[model samples]
Target: MITALLVLVAFGSSAQSGYDLWLNYRPMEASVRATQFKAMMSHVYFAGSSPQLQAAREELTRAAKGMLKTAIVNTPADQAQLIIGNIDQIAKRGDILKLSKAERPTGDGFIIRSVTNKGRKAVVVTGGTDLGVLYGVFAFLRHVQTNKDLTNLQITEHPKMMHRILDHWDNPNRSVERGYAGFSIWNWHKLPGYTDPRYTDYARANASVGINGSVLNNVNANVIMLTPAYLAKAKALADVFRPYGIKVYLSIKFSSPIELGKLSTADPLDPQVRKWWKDKVDEIYSVIPDFGGFLVKANSEGQPGPQSYGRTHADGANMLGEALAPHHGIVMWRAFVYDNNVPDDRAKQAYSEFKPLDGKFNDNVIVQVKNGAIDFQPREPFHPLFGAMAKTPLMLEVQLTQEYLGFSTHLVYEAPLFKECLDADTYAKGKGATVAKVLEGTYQPGKLTGMAGVANIGTDLNWCGHPFAQANWYSFGRLAWDPGASAEAIADDWLRMTFTNDKRFIDPIKDHMMRSRENTVNYMTPLGLHHIMSADGHYGPGPWTDKMPRADWTAVYYHKADSLGIGFDRTATGSNAVAQYFPEVRDHFADLSTCPDIYLLWFHHLSWNYKMRSGKTLWDELVDHYYKGAAAVQGMQKVWNGMRPYVDATRYNEVKQLMAVQYDEAIRWRNSCVLYFQTFSKKPIGDQYSKPEHDLQYYRSLHYYNVPGLGTN
Candidate 1:
């Protein structure tokens, strides 16, 4: 069947392994105890006729039939036990909600409450707008799917940021950049027709957690995406997404005017350049009126931008912002820029380039900054720009794809990494000013707020390559909705929905997830060691690797390992990148005594014999962290092995095998890092742990072929 319409799959059918995602309409087995939540959804009624509202109805029906073993009949708002609709629909039905000051929704916020109808309990899923109401429907379904109590139900929620987007780095041909999952899901050749049912499933999964936008192409753009042909294909996907309230956006090559329009110059200051963009944007809106906007990655990693014309980043961003503004669209201009020729620290390049242009950006443009000043490392201090850009609205961009964390092969729960950054005190507006508060416009009111994740999805049957990787995608959306949300809380909800609700299963898995990120860090780059992944592939450890076209691109440049000691010194005597932060944050990282052990190596170059806070020498601490990381994976394996009784055979086996691969890779990471770093420290591999199975030369000689994600292109 063509993909344009919804396609339902039978549970346990060979046709689908994970095409259902978390929206599995599979009913509870007879062996499992059922929830006492049937009364909450006894008689459902929806009061709106829009496509979005209709989708809300269909979703509820599908979920109710599966989870409660019955279908819902449409009834009048007041008579039905459950009423679902937007404010306009509720008002049309004579204010069935009678929204109170506390219960009233603001913007895209939703309120799910228990209201009295003739002295009978009735649940109302409603919001101030149709989009919000649709979100409420999904929220209600999630509550049921997780087997939570519905009585005295009151959930008032709104996204903390306006644009919670997933940036898919999928290219035109289907190959993904740094994508550990299989090929890209967007079948470009077959699009604009034969829509896949998977498209709808993707939308449903996104809306279930309140993600409202997506960038459908790679940041390393091709001008062809801006053409009429591809826009038609994009429009097709946008149509499928609209019912779920997700607006489609594109990543445009900054020189599109030159390549697509055959212009001599794509300069922002040039009149011809401005008119070309205006005309192109007009053409796009004509095809898809609600086309979200453009995501630009220019003057970074060799992509052309206004910098090619001797113009600042603001020049490039403001020009595009002007074109999108009339259509109520916005431009997301990336701040991941640096000049290789600039004789400055690579870590400090983005701040030096963008910090000066803060107030100069147009109001409609958001400066998209990576979570770290450097590329997506396993763990790095929060980007200095989090608080530095008061005049500019900054969007926190993180990677959901495990590019550095071991791709899809190894399991790493990313919410802890995200929370660490969000909770960090930027001190931009003095104490208690966190990165989350800054993104919420607490530091600068009336500014645009957004959070973006580099997508990990692909054409794999399970969606994310590893089954557990799905939790990272789930966590990103939940946190994007509310930055202050507990990572553990999100994991609990996801565990119950995606796996089992059994406490025996939930308790151990949640603990495993909470510790997963730190575990990967320990085995890989413990104690604040950042960006030591292998060159080009970034697939394996390569701290000893210094040979690359660009000096800073290699692992050796960041770690600065030498005969004296290891780690880079960002203090006043060194690169002094710490100065970019507010005085308090700078001072906090500058002092070795005051600095946290987790970030010691990131900020200072300490001696191998230097004492750590744990009372272990730097050499011993490093070795211990690497071994601890590998051992933790074994612990995870033990936990999952015990979950077999609670999980199905297919899922149980999938996770079991992945955990085995993770264990092997963890050992490899430990061995390679421990062996290589030992050369500089000249210390013995402590007698307690196993010695390196192979020498450093053995690892360096191990050449891999056809690793995924790094496209042949």
Candidate 2:
């Protein structure tokens, strides 16, 4: 009997192992709110028989059983304490619900309100469509999970963007590009016949946050993904996600006609190539009727594209767009291209290539631009393409994987980084043209708007490798759903739902999460220093990395440190990259006196003894930021150590150990960068600062092998 009890305990613990994400639905403590929730949820009336409706019913039943510890009895709509369905299904009881026509939710939106029906108190969860009703159910559960009062609850929500997507860089072989977590969750060898239960859970987690689409494979395309055998595999995953409102998309090889169909040429303008693409898209739709569309990465990093045939980006994207248009599908064409042979600033390449072709793309094609001009640096000013491309629909793509920010070991909450980009003013129309507004199509109505996060998920027990890394995934969804949502509030809700609602744990931990991104920026790439990470895997500090086949790929190309000064010069006399933005924004960045300290180095190369706003030399200020950033990681360790009683032992210990690793790496970054850059500055290592543990050569000689997330091109 004792042995059986031990097995049961282990099973119970395993069941709660971060696998459920924010929907764990742990039993509520005895309280007035719990009693009220239990009473109200004792009987539920969920109507309709659609698959989405069934999914909602199952979710509500599961949540009730877990949180309230009671089985909900199916009751007639008139007698039930809780009524759930689409608004039209419950229109007969509209008198008590009192929903105004203006209050009615449009698109994938929902409304939840408390009402009285026939002298009985009831709460209604509903929307305009079945998918909306499903979203409403999750919102209602989140309300209860956060311990919010339900006495007079009234809530209305609608997604700000039309398409919220997770772009998984999982390869056909199960290796993920820049994935820090374990192997890809998709067991391709076993898929199309044996669907993992984890796939269903992934859909549920995404649905809970209003994420509606997913691209299944790496942007670095595989020809096999477009073949019949693999299309069937994608179809199986789509079936699991359909009920949750997630439509599956795939990344395609641009030259598939030549490789797969044995065609002589794969030029977009060629009649044979166009016919092949059209037939392939039709074949895909026959298998997965609701396949969202294709995401293409072309003419960048050796990926084949229209440029190979001397054709424009539009020619290639329009060819795919024309094929998918008949199926009501869209094509997401990435704007991350940069020619290595070009002598211009690498940051300016994407804008230069795509800006002129803004109105040239087909209606179904969206120019998917990265959040910043460069790769996902620790921090970057908003991409200039955001406000410039007025005629074409643009989708904001941000990375959730911690590639350059310490690869899942460091506890960095990325909500602030996301928010920083969203909140930046573009000065497109006037003063208040924020990137969020541009994404919402506020200035140009009736255009498609979307956000895509490069997923950090994998086969780890916690999904994200680091326990705290899960918060970045959660934040991405929330911000994608509503760009104006508060990062702090989202962090607070995640903490309460994922761990505990205790105030002691909530307040300090929330502050730590909010500060995490900035702390990482300070230690890794402080003051607009971008992309100086070690080559290939980008695992650690390598500010001195200069030798490479392409000059733009080296660290020395960006920082430009010399005996005179440091930083990339983008002013009129330099690359003139600042001219890409609107006049107001260009002026702010182009003028040395007006630029923000955070972005000082990005736009100007400055003297080592240049006096900063704080009356310190540029070298001194740089040193101070590095020291403080490393110290902040120690502070994070202290914060997590104090929360041991609140979080589960498995997660608590995991985080505690990861925190130790981050602190050590943080020190390494500080020492390596300071010592290397000190060579050019000829400055003293201040007495107040911590001395480097090893000489610069020792840090430079260190090489890491077998780093996770290194994908083959």
Candidate 3:
């Protein structure tokens, strides 16, 4: 009897350490909703019988069983209480839901309505295609999970972008570049024979948020992936992801024709190279019919490309685009390139190289540009290339992995960061021409539109290394589907599904997440100070790392701190990088008086005694921001401590321990930056904050090599 009681107690208090992500349907919270769901969702009449539909059926049944404690039964279409299928399938029955002509959705849109047909109450979920039907099911489940009443449901949602994708930086041997999570989830050696169940779960998580595609390999491409043996392994994974509406793409080495096919030259203008690519593309299509095309990282960071043969980027991209275009696929030619030999600003290289060749790209080619001109810094001005490319299609690339914002250890919410870039007023087509509008084809309607993120997924039990880090993945997919969606609203939705929906828990936690990005910025790269991460590993602060293989690779090169002042002046008197933007933005950012203080150091160097808007000197203001950010982490600890009653013990404890580490790291970042910068400013630490524990020489002597995600380990 004692043993039985113990077992019941353990079962009742099951721990959820975030393995399920936001899809954790943790049982019914409201009795009335449960009863309504049980009554209205008993018999599901699904007309389609594809593998995609099978996945949807299983998802609905799982949610129904978990959320309503009801077993979903399959009944005839005429007698069922719920109906799900494409529009054509529903139209054959006639007047099932009586959806208005104006209500009809096209593309990947769907419609979910609670209707009455022949005196029988039923909820009909129909879409333009089978993929849309699957999306509708996930949407309906979200509504149920969020405790919204489904009595008179009317929701019509279609993706704003055609391709919502995740770009994995996974290497062939299982190393991930800039991936702060664990190792790559793709087990290349075990593939073709052992299909990990986790692959299906990965697809389900992405599909739930409207993400439709994933590039399986790193942009720093390996030519071996094009070999027959690797293609078979990729086909295996693609087959598993097919049911969840995901199309797998690959990153091909630009010199693959020469390296893999033993051609004399991989030049785009060469006939043999062109034929080789066509044959390779055909081989890929045969293996996986629904295969997406290549994502090339060419002529950047020593990656081989057409530049080696005096050919342009468009020349390289168009060659691959022509090969994939015949198969209804595309080529995502990366615009994240820089010149090591050029003395010009590294930020301006991509714009100068690609802007001239914008209109020259083929119809099936897209230039995938990074959010910032520089590497993924904690804070950066939006890339000027967004509005500059009028004739060419450009997709915004944001990093979901925390390479610069404290890796997987820090609790940094990235929705606000993404929204910042998307909502920036480019003034390209007039006053309200936002970056989001430009990418959505507002100026050029005939072009394809899309957004991509560098994925942080790996082999950890919780998926993302940090439990809170999972929210970045959720936010990326949500924003990719609809750029106009508010980050705060998305955070609230994720919070409700991932944890508790109680107002007491939601209100405070949402506030914490919303402030997280800025808090990290303040400590790591406040007031436009960027890319000061410690060498190669980028694990911590290293502002004094002045010597490296190249001047651009060092922290001192960008910050340019000296005895006179600090900052990289991008005004006409300096590099004139601001000229890349529209006249409105160029003038505003160029003027020291007009530029916001948040980006003051980014555009111009200032005296240490210069007065800030806060009426404090620049030195005092910088030190204050650093100290306050570290203190905020302590406050976060207090907030999490108060919500122990609401969160599961496993998650609560995990976050608590992690927050403790974050507090220490926050202190490390704050002190190291302020102390190092002080060497140049020749100023004392702010009176409010404590002095650094060690001297500048002491901090610089510290070493942290062989960190995870550097591709070495």
Candidate 4:
């Protein structure tokens, strides 16, 4: 299958393990279960009929029946083996069933463990709320699915970020922006009548990862979505997601006052425009009372905003936030704005526009900032805006789609990227001011916190295009729930759920994924080389690209590979973009010698002959990275090949075949980039690696003009 057409579909044949994702609820081999999970089914009891409660009941029932391949009989007896209940309903049973409260300060926490219920052995699943019950059920199912002993399973958990959302850049026309997955899941034309079962599965998968909200449209939004007709379409999805505790949000076009309401001006200060938005908010909430509010893309990349009327970003955000305040909704204003025709550095634009407007936003507004200052690159330093605003609610926005990372073809686990940013010490209010602390409300008081991922899900049978890509989605939710959680821990849980819990499968795969993103960065943009892909499609290498209208838009702007040196000088002598960060961070990137070598080239241009810490000249080190990256991918293929017995034949074969594509492409990336940059360095391939198969011109001629199943995010 082409890289772009991987869609999320629920059903696969009973003969294959690919369909189950990490939730493969297949009946365990009788011998294995008898020794491991048989204690899970001595008795069963469930209390409550709320939709969320029923959801938990149904999920557990389906999983248990599927894995055990037998009816788990309900027991009315006091010592039910699998006892389940909401906190209020379960407390009545008293000491006869002493269910210790799970230490979850948040509403969504669950504990499942063995306990003696009136002298009878029981496995109790109890939580403070229905959502907690749902989490408990999933947790319980995971234990059984992973063939773990159910005798003493005690777990309590809650989301770290108040709002973990998936922003689907899906349009009514079925086009998805930057989506490698198939067409949009929202079938607008048939939505009011025909409901796709996929919606339920999407919600279920998100709930499993503790993602509680989803914005159903693109940030480059269309005003038509707010109209009465489309609101009906959105309401259908909201209804399906409500039971799963996932509130639906919409991406609003700032010019909606003019387009949707037929007003003359969409100025933020105008009373008519303010009233128009307020009325629209009221209308939307009337239909979907729990509607999660608006995500706006004002004055960025052709999107209209308050800037159109000489108002700051705050003016636009506060105007909409005021409207949503009464209804308990929020306005997520994007901080991705950069002037289209300006010659200024792209990295400096967003900070310049947003830093001054920080404290002016309404309390209900969250400034949605991307992980990096520039657009999503193969690698980038954490965004300067993270700790710049001390008095405002802010949300971290991460891209799960792999738009700039080799798309679906490359096996890049993004948990490391997420962790790098979350763990970055911002030094805003003093030491220990991490980005996680800022958004999670640990450092800042009374501020609503959030994290969002640009979803890579679509209509594919497997959910994310690549089966392993599903893990990225899983990791994003886990990290959002608790940024302190280790990437390996999250990957371990996902491996057990998506595949076998066998050490052979888990250990090897985990090692491969943990190192995969770094390996990708090593080849594609080592030493901070970024945004060097083909002009339009952004698929392959195009480091020689130039002559665009804006100087910053060209690859030349980022990788200034001249005889003088290479890299954008963000130091005082250059763009001075480093000054945007806090002083602690500012000093780190301000000096070329002091700047971390990983970002050495990003902050300062260096002569090709400059000796690197690796004891090799800069030119040789760059070549080594390209070679090393390609070699690591080959190593991944070998690891996967050895695990043929651990995975289903279909998924195993799918991944195996894709590995061949990745290896071929990795070589292409290596050769093309190395050969192009070698022109400036005037260096040899060296005796360590083989010479390039083709020259730069030959590599450039291999035009991928026909992008199969491309998206426009």
Task: Report the number of the highest-TM-score candidate.
Answer: 2
Please give each candidate's TM-score. 0.97, 0.98, 0.97, 0.95
- In model 2, the worst 10-residue window by lDDT is 1-10
Per-residue error for 329 in candidate 4, Å, reads: 0.9
Compared to the true structure, candidate 2 yields what TM-score? 0.98
Show how many residue pairs clash in every candidate, following the order shown.
3, 0, 0, 14
Candidate 2 structure quality by residue, lDDT tens digits, 494-552: 98888889999999999999999999999988878988999857989989989888988
Candidate 1 on 187-294: residue-level lDDT in tens? 999999868788898998999899999999999998889889999999999999999989999999989888888899999999999999999999999999999998
On lDDT, the leading prediction is 2
Candidate 2: count of backbone clashes, pairs at least 3 residues apart or interchain: 0
lDDT of 3 by residue, 1-713 (tens): 01123323544432354767888877886578777777667867998887878888988887886677777989888787789998878888886866567777666789998888667878888888888889888888888778788788888888889889999999998999888778899999999998877788888989999999999999988888999999999999999999998999999999998899999999999999999999999999999999999999999999999999999999999999999998999999999999789899999999999999979999889899898999889889999998999899999999999998888889999999999999999898889999999888889897988999999898766778888999999999999999999999999889888898898999998999999998999998888888788995888898888889888889998888888888888999899999999999998888877898878888887788888889999888889899989999889889999999999987888889999999888988888899889989999885667887887777788787688887831
362 Cα displacement, candidate 4 (Å): 0.8
lDDT of candidate model 2 versus the reference: 0.90
lDDT, candidates in the order shown:
0.87, 0.90, 0.88, 0.83
Q: For candidate 4, write residues 149-184 as lDDT tens digits.
A: 665666666667888999999987888888877789
Model 3 C-alpha lDDT versus the unseen true structure: 0.88
Query: Could you tell which candidate, 1 or 2, scores higher by lDDT?
Result: 2
Which residue pairs does candidate 1 place in steric collision? 3-195, 3-196, 4-195
